[model samples]
Target: MARLIDLSIDSDQVIQHLKHEVKLKTVYQSILCKQIIEKASQERGITVEPEEVQAEADQFRYDHKLESASQTLEWLEDNLLTPDDWEAGIYDQLLKKKLADSLFGKQIEAYFAQSKVQYEQAVLYRILVPYSALAQEIFYQVEEEEISFFEAAHLYNIDEYRRLACGFEGKVSRWQLKPDVAAYVFGAHPREVIGPIQSGHDFELLMVEEFIPAELTNDVRQQISSQLFDEWLESELNHLVYSQ
Candidate 1:
């Protein structure tokens, strides 16, 4: 029997597949977001120059280790994208970035200043267990130097994968913690042990290592930009839906 070669799928087939997989809503939202960016950027005269798109594409290719044109083409083939499709994607991303900066760049510093306290970070080691009695036992053991926080977490934490991490939740911000837990952890001094407190189903014992004062670092700037852009996008999307 002869073999069938390289079957092709059309846009309608792709849409049908998305619907079948119950992913049409997610794909639809993404398409709407792209349309929003294109329209809004054009209105604001936020054009993404060819040079900018080329630079972005080069950076992307470098990031993905696609060093040569052949390697890039192979990658595009693997990802089911043609050169034009990939270039258009890079252009779309650059346009969105320019639009986001134009709309929210001036407001980031003010927003960061307002939310500075929420960005304060803490380094803590934790031991969490199912019961309070065991937690109290571990607390005393740790307090008296009979056992270390790391050792207790290694031995007793029920979540095996998290046992490693519970021993070191590196640089968690105030926003990341529950309000009650944040209050205790932030108030405690360095090297202080606090908790065996009720955390939903588990009792958690935390040992604070250090506190990091919030600063407007580059990472935080990028975070704020993304955050503000997402908020704007969601609001625009909601308005569009409601008006329709």
Candidate 2:
């Protein structure tokens, strides 16, 4: 049997490589997942049509704004991929998505409805500072109407865009936030100023400008379905047993 890599290096070097090379684990996981996907796809008689693969490849070009064939070819060269290689990769991805949909698409709506709260979005303003006292001062000023949150954010926020936009983090779901931050922000009423909360090296002042409760829009349903399918695939992969 062929091993995955050269074993000619010193034992200490091998040990150090194994310890420090994080991407090696990810590569191994990808290989294992592909094997599983291939087997499952075959058993289910799932196949990718050439037209579908070509359409996907065309869409990929369109998405990247590759207007000309030469541009597409140049992009392929830059990415170290040939046209056939790119098409094959797209085919594999499409096959996996189809298989996942076949297995789990029917469950998406119920899952989205059940887990809706996690998907609720908030339009937020924030001021992040290194010191708690400064964060508190800014929060009080915003709260008292002495300074708008945007003004405070523009003046004091450490984040680049927050400094420019007055701390607008845009619309974000709970899962996109740190656990403690999500807990505080999601529970807050719209337009309420809340914070001086610690996050990493910074204390943050948060204001919820608007709260958007979760609704099972077509897009949300699709997202929930894909998320559930991914979870199922992960669980299946974890529980796979091998025989010696």
Candidate 3:
């Protein structure tokens, strides 16, 4: 034990700070979730092999560029974690991953098939301006190729962040947009400019970069699995609370 900075704290202070930070409820929920996961995993015999944990730990160290044993030890010390604690954390993560897959891996395909449309994604560019006239002007400029969409966006977009991004909205899911707006964006073909769309006090011009039709991707599968696991956890937690 070496001190980076001298600190004084107690269990009561930690609890008080957690409460003040509005994190006590979240902390309780997370602890309860781990307990529930532990029981469920044991029941199903979903366990993480030591080798798997070691592999993950190796990857983690590499990702963080902890190139040597000393560096790895220093990193753990900086995070206030012992080697055992790090191994345990890795074990817990691996266990939850195994448990998630064991429970929901086979169900992902059918669930995806049942909810295909929800997975449709679009890559888009947009220019949002305060005036319909300005939006329409920008739209024709884009359509006629007098100026590029990205140029128009950077020059005229109202949002500072969007202006810098040239209005690039990455891989937008259908649910992320308003119904009327989504219809126009999703139905339009690639490179088709789809608005001067009136939205409250603002008007927006949209262009579809590409449409990624619903398909099962590895990332999508992982996402669906995590979603299923979370829903199951929430339901279990609710039932546990209600029973109590």
The lDDT leader among the candidates is 3
Structure candidate 2, residue pairs in collision: none
Write model 2 residue lDDT over 1-244, tens digit each, in one string.
Answer: 2123453456566556766976566656677788888888899999999999989988988999999999999888767678898998998899988888888778877777677788889998888899999998887887789998888889998999889988898988887898888999988988788888988888998989998988778777667767876787777778773431
Which residue segments of model 2 deviate by more than 4 Å? 1-20, 241-244
Task: At residue 42, give the lDDT of candidate 2.
Answer: 94
Q: Which 10 consecutive positions of candidate 3 have the poorest summed lDDT?
A: 1-10
Q: After superposing candidate 3, which stretches have Cα over 4 Å from the reference?
A: 1-4, 128-137, 140-146, 158-162, 175-180, 196-204
* RMSD, every candidate, angstroms: 3.5, 4.8, 2.9
TM for candidate 1 is 0.86
lDDT of each: 0.88, 0.83, 0.90
lDDT of 1 by residue, 1-244 (tens): 1112467777788888899999999988989999999999989988988899899899988898999999999888778788899989989988888999999999999999999998899987887799999999999998999988888889899877768665776788888899988999999999888988988898989988999999999888888899999999999988887899
Deviation in angstroms for 219 in model 3? Answer: 0.5
* Model 2, TM vs. native: 0.87
Which pairs clash in the backbone of model 1?
A: none
- Per-residue lDDT tens digits for candidate 3, residues 75-177, read 9988878999999999999899999999999999999999888789999888889998888888888889999989999999998888999999788878678
